[model samples]
Target: MRAARFRPGACLVLALVAVLAGGTQQASAETSPNLAIDAPPSAVVMTAPLDPSPGTLLTFSVAVTPGTNPTSTGLYVNCDLSWLGLGPSAPLFDDGTNGDPTAGDLTFTVQATIPSGTKPGTRLGDCGVFDAESRSASTSYSVNVVPAATDVGPSVTDTVPLSDATDVATDANVTITFSEAVDATGSWYALSCASSGDHTASVTGGPQSYLLDPGTDFAAGELCTVTVTA
Candidate 1:
């Protein structure tokens, strides 16, 4: 057998070998930001104050940590308000311009309101926290709806024909809507006229809705005013 010799050309390739004394595979990076709902012992923590008044704002946060910056982030607060079917949605906010909230810190806010009728004492409210990454967290918070120092005084909320109404039809029955309920004793319409023109309420309409037929038909051009005594 004859020994052959290799010649190096202009494009000759050389094999490169790397040897490690301790031969260990490299560790994967962990800078991917994580979505943290809140601080804890309790992940679901209350952001509202103790004995919060009805209509008080309750707030919480969706935080990111050890997060790779240059990321787009956002959050939302979801609550079912019987008074208002759905809460509002939020939009994303990016901090990449400043290279901030980039690696170890950043948070977004989610806020809700305690309904006016949220009874006095502790009430449980579950508000959802959603982040830009499509991750979600929920916090069950205890809110103390402060006792209404004063009675929930009844007030007119809406009316059928509208207020300061002009050119109203003579046959039109006045419909008044109240914020809360009232009995016949507390519910009455006092007409500007001293004479009781038949101010009768219709119970069938709804507890909050009262239809009043001003005793009799209006004298044309008579400026009539009706006030609800609740």
Candidate 2:
């Protein structure tokens, strides 16, 4: 048999293969871009100090980092003043647009008025951030309110003592001063003598003060103590 001669088409196909292989090697040498967001250690952190008085203005902020531009983002706060248990539910105040998720490194402000007549103690509330382009993030915080202290004990600022040795009594009437003006019908005073037992207590004149009438006689030249519990 005579040796057969191959066509030039084979050489062209081999050349094309060499070109494709070179292109693939070049592509593998290129670097890629980072398409992820650097979220904070804590998605939500305390942004402001708590209010000290009821009805005081409270402001806070939230920080977020989305791997990509979000389609929509906003904040919502849940306030619970249920401790009062006598009025409407606590209201939420927001300062950011509800639906715009295409932005990055966004800061939002939330303001709320502490409900009036809130009890004096630590109040808890929660906040959350939602990015329609991503997921929902949330946090919680506490607000502390100091109680108003009022004097609810007796005073002799405007009382006169009986004269004459024989007419003078060892026992004296006690008075009380309330920290705040309270309803006389709803408020009462309690008095207990160290030496004697429970004594009768009464509210006289205005709603802010109370007078205690001694139920038992006191010994002369003896030390006596009275406690007014509100």
Candidate 3:
């Protein structure tokens, strides 16, 4: 007899990195030997929601000092979140669109979706300016990716070795998959062998998947109960 059990685990709060790209108004950037490399904004002020949930459509705004840069074709926010398993890079605009208050103002803004499955935490990235010649310089910034005020814990979506499996292989490993990435910081698991008494297994795997390997094979003809607590 082989049985499987699941216990809800604590939620791990991570961030959604947003990479800022070139604005639409900016002239096509081309390399030029005489192009002047504008200095990064003398000041960078980013504006974002206090608490944004996954899949939420939100506006990110960045205001910089010296709104007037004669040599600058446009300004932009440069950052990346793909490393965090989230959405790709996007641009922040100063053209009075995408939530910008005024066109030509140093205040750049863009409306973007917070990729679904993004964990809750502070997401950090960079911001900068670009010349028509494609030269750029940037400064750092951070945004808080928060969960909804009314939030729920991660749930089990599926598992390996379907529940109540019989005649299971002695060396079969157990795997658990979740609806969302789990914290697994203080998680644990156990393998109870009816004939061999208590048994232990090593736990491994990731943000949404977990694997369990027993130290030794299970008894040939005995009840094996595997319990996992996320």
Backbone N/Cα/C clashes per model: 3, 9, 5
Tell me how far candidate 1 lies from the true structure as C-alpha RMSD in angstroms: 16.8
lDDT of each: 0.52, 0.51, 0.67
Query: Which candidate tops TM-score?
Result: 3
**50, model 1: CA deviation in Å?**
7.9
lDDT of 1 by residue, 23-106 (tens): 332322344456755421112343445676777765544443321232334544444333222333432123422222333334
Tens-place lDDT per residue, model 2, 1-230, is: 99989879998999999999998988887755657663422245343344466656555455544423433444333334344342233433333333222233455444555567777787665555555444555566666776544536543333223212233355777655555555555434454435554566444666665565666665565444444334
10 residues in a row with least lDDT, candidate 1: 91-100
In angstroms, the error of model 1 at 78 is 43
Candidate 3 overall Cα lDDT vs. reference?
0.67
Q: What TM-score, over all chains together, does every model reach?
A: 0.32, 0.33, 0.40
Which segments of candidate 3 are over 4 A away from where they belong? 1-40, 66-77, 81-89, 133-135, 151-230
Q: Give the per-residue lDDT of model 3 (tens digit) for 1-230.
A: 88886444422221111112343223345542475444534446465565677877766666665433354455565444452343456566778887888998777787677777888888776656555546566667676777766667788787787777888897888888889998765546667888887666687898889887878888787887766674
Regions of candidate 2 where Cα sits further than 4 Å from its true position: 1-27, 31-51, 54-67, 70-117, 149-230
lDDT of 2 at 82: 49
Q: Which of the two candidates, 2 or 3, achieves a greater lDDT against the reference?
A: 3
